[model samples]
Target chain A: MDQQKLFVQIALHSWNTQIARAEKVFNSYSESEFYKQIAPGKNRIIYLYGHLAVYHDLLKETLGLDTGKYSVLSPLFLQNPDNQESEMPPVKELKAIWNEVHCDLKELFNNVAPEDWFKRHNAMTDADFEKDPSRNRLSVVLNRANHVAYHLGQVVLVKPENI
Target chain B: MDQQKLFVQIALHSWNTQIARAEKVFNSYSESEFYKQIAPGKNRIIYLYGHLAVYHDLLKETLGLDTGKYSVLSPLFLQNPDNQESEMPPVKELKAIWNEVHCDLKELFNNVAPEDWFKRHNAMTDADFEKDPSRNRLSVVLNRANHVAYHLGQVVLVKPENI
Candidate 1:
């Protein structure tokens, strides 16, 4: 494969691996387990799930793939920390949304041509992008993959093996 | 820059970003906090630091950069889980080891040519590498970056902000 294509493949593979790992962690948790904190006073599994979903939904928008569908989650998952007085969306509903958002993203991501990933996304101004082209769509995916891995480590703490 | 160099830059950027984040988290913890669990029964901060150091040390070997100097850490950090009967290295020694390993890796990584990163490393057999070229030196770095991010998240739970 050409260098550009190979780079794209590596980036996508990294992203998918982390996403799959996150899904496996999320799936292992019972609904009751979702209520458990990653640590004594850290974010709960449900909150992390919702936070990831919201960020991914925004990732789609950043890639110019799709406008995010989970805007309602912003206040609860994005703008605030866990254990607020505000009630979270039901676990069942959040789970469904998580699957739906990722499914759509996976398809969209696969279709993007390797060179297209180098283009500036919606989040950045063209002037800034011109100054530093390194802040491209692929960079966002790379960073988000790390973000997922970070939380995956935390949420796994709630599982039986960790304790 | 050529496509190959750009790809190398991106991979190295991802690796370096995670390393810096992990360092920041490690540096933030007081000596006492190193004994705290990420969760109720999860790995402690000190263990995670040693674990990361050992893995990065091994990464040097995998990349054919250097034979690992920190083999002594393997019994405590790599071979056993936290809270074992085995005594841990002091926090000061682990901290120094962590910095030394990463400093050497950073210099070595910078010196490697872009195309060289796509070459197979010592861990893989030639036939297997021919079949699956994706398991190259760069892939190991990418994977290890995520690994660091994972532990970084867990360790950050020890911070006052997260708690």
Candidate 2:
């Protein structure tokens, strides 16, 4: 296999693995469980879910793909910390948005040629990219994959004690 | 830059990014803070630190590199859940081990060529690896990088809430 292609595949594999782990945790939690904080005074699992959803939704634009359809989520999930004066969407609506963002991201990511991932996304100016070309689209995926795994660790704290 | 080499560098960049984040979280906490649990009835921050230390130690062997010197920590940190009958190493010693493991790993990893990371490590049997060539050294790094980030999230809950 071409080494570069192989590298991309492996990166994607890790991304998928984290995403699947997050999905498993999300599916396992009851709605009430999502409301519970991972720790005292920390954000709840639902907040983390919404955080990831919005980040991923914005990721499409970061990839220089389509603009995110869920721009409204940014204020609730991204700009502010959880438990702001504003209210978050219902858990049912957040779940749908999560599913839709990932579905769209999967298709959008698939359309990108393996080589094109090396190019800078809209997030970077050409001058800045030239200064540090390491900030490519694939790096975003790598970083965000770890980001997902990071939050998943916190989210798993809501697991029922028995099992 | 060659795309293949660039990919390796970015992968390493992500690995280093997570490591720095983990290190920051580990360094920020006081020794007493390390004793605090991420949540009620879960593992303490110190245990997770030792957990990562032990895993990174074992990773040397998984990479077909040097045997881990910290094998003694395996039973305390890896095999059993927190609060077993056996006692863990002191916080001071665990911190020393964590530093040592990462120091050794950094040197060992630098020695391996970019292309060499694509080769299968000893942890996988030849036939099994042949069936799935993606199980390479680089993949291990990617997986473990996320593993570190995952635990880092849980560990951060031990933070002194003001920040």
Candidate 3:
């Protein structure tokens, strides 16, 4: 594999590893514990779960990948940290949403052509490039991985014993 | 402020927002739930905390910034998900470490001369530069914000229902 291919491979593997790791940590919490917040300003476990699920869907849309029935930017799925009861799905339902989103992402990855990986897609603004001047797909992938790993740390920090 | 300063300001604000968000979610879990692995093969709360603390320290060192007594790439701080018991730190200690590291990062950001933010550091490896020419201080900082936001999602997901 060439450099771009190698980077994509690393991204795929890293995402898989993070997902696996997150799944293990997530499963250990009870339903109630998953929704608990230790302090007034803190977020509940449900918020984190919802955030991940929503983000994956958004990323797929940003990359122009198919996200099935999910609208990546749906307001219904977005959480306001202050509004605990607003637009929150039940734990089981949210997990299902997460799984579905992940599945779509996997399919998108599998179908992405190696050449296509270098195609520049403007993520922040959602613009499509006529010819991607910034051939930096690998950087984007790495960015995403770094993004996931960073948040994973927060999830680990707040567990009861650690507090 | 010039465009460069504007960019840095935005980046800094984004990072601060994300760190605060993560802290909020983390404060919500019970001791057992915080350490518990909810999904198979996922990281426990402590493991995630340790990784972020260590990685942030590494980024600081990579940029030739002062990290006080913290050493980058410390093997002792590296947590292997497979060995949860060996890697977990007490919640208080982990939070302290995170706070200290974040403070160091904040200081680094505060002290950044505009020119330095745009300066191109030597690539960590040949592959990093080969992947993209924009892998400079600005890009690195931007990428770091994305990194933090991604992991913050995970923290929110795994939080316990009762503190």
Candidate 4:
């Protein structure tokens, strides 16, 4: 594969792998465990799940993809920090939207061109972007994947006492 | 910048950002909290820190860079789980090695080229790799970043519970 194409290929694979790992850890949770906090005062498994979905919603906007069906996710889940000043939907509702947003975003990633990826987006300016070209679409994609992995680590602690 | 070069640039930024975030989170923990389980019985904060360094040691070898100073990290941290059959190093000792390993590897990453990143490594075969080009050096780098982010999430729960 061409090197340019290879970047997208590796990135998407890493993104999907991280997501599948999170799904495996998450799906194993009983609905009760989903709501259970990892520690006495830590974010619950459900919050982390919703937290990841919220970031994906941000990714859709940041990457200039079509907006998701669950626009409410941002206000409910974004930057509120867990267990503070917020009420969350039940696990079933959030879970449905989680699946919905991921499916939609994956479709968006499929059509990105190498040249398009290098162009700056999301609040970046031409002069600043020209100085440091790394801050572009590809960075945003990897940033989302990193976000998923970060939360996956947290959710892994929710259960699997031995692991 | 060339598209291939841009891939390296983004990979490096994502890699460094994940590290800086982990460092901030890890540094915030007290000496006591470093040993506290992320949850009831999962890995401790210190274990996750050691785990990341161990993976970077592997990256050094796998990418044909210089070996890290601490081979003991692999036996103590890798796949051992926490509070298990193997004993772990003290937080101060592990902290030293963690910083040492990250500093060394960042230097290694600076020397990598886009073409070198595209070549197959580890167990990949020429034909199999051609069919799945994502299994390359760039993937390994991104894979490590994802790994760090995943654990960063878990360790974030260990203390500063509000964060």
Q: Of the candidates shown, which would achieve the greatest DockQ relative to the real structure?
A: 4
**Candidate 2 deviant stretches above 4 angstroms:** A161-163
Count of steric clashes across candidates, in order: 0, 0, 40, 2
lDDT of 2 by residue, B3-112 (tens): 76787788888888988888888998888887887888888888899999999999999999899998887888888778834576888998899899999999998998
Residue B108 shift from truth in candidate 3, angstroms: 18
| lDDT value, residue B8 of candidate 2 | 77
Q: Is candidate 1 or candidate 3 better by DockQ?
A: 1
Q: Which window of 10 residues has the lowest lDDT sum in candidate 1 chain A?
A: A154-163
Across residues B25-115, which tens digit of lDDT does each residue of candidate 3 receive? 6776766666765334555666666666777777775666663455532454553342565645578877788898888888787998865
Q: What are the runs in model 3 whose C-alpha is more than 4 Å off?
A: A122-137, B1-163
Better of 1 and 2 by DockQ: 1
Model 1: per-residue lDDT, tens digit, A23-104? 8879988899888888777898889999999989888988899889988779888888997456988999998999999999
lDDT of 4 by residue, A56-115 (tens): 866777777665556666665775767744677888988887888888877787877756
Ordered list by lDDT, greatest first? 1, 2, 4, 3
TM-scores for all predictions: 0.96, 0.95, 0.51, 0.91
Q: What tens-digit string does per-residue lDDT give for candidate 1 at B70-162?
A: 887788888888874558788998889999999999889989988999998889999998887777898888889999999888888877676
Rank by DockQ, descending? 4, 1, 2, 3
Error of 4 at A10 (Å): 1.2
Candidate 1 residue runs with Cα over 4 Å from true position = none
Best by TM-score: 1
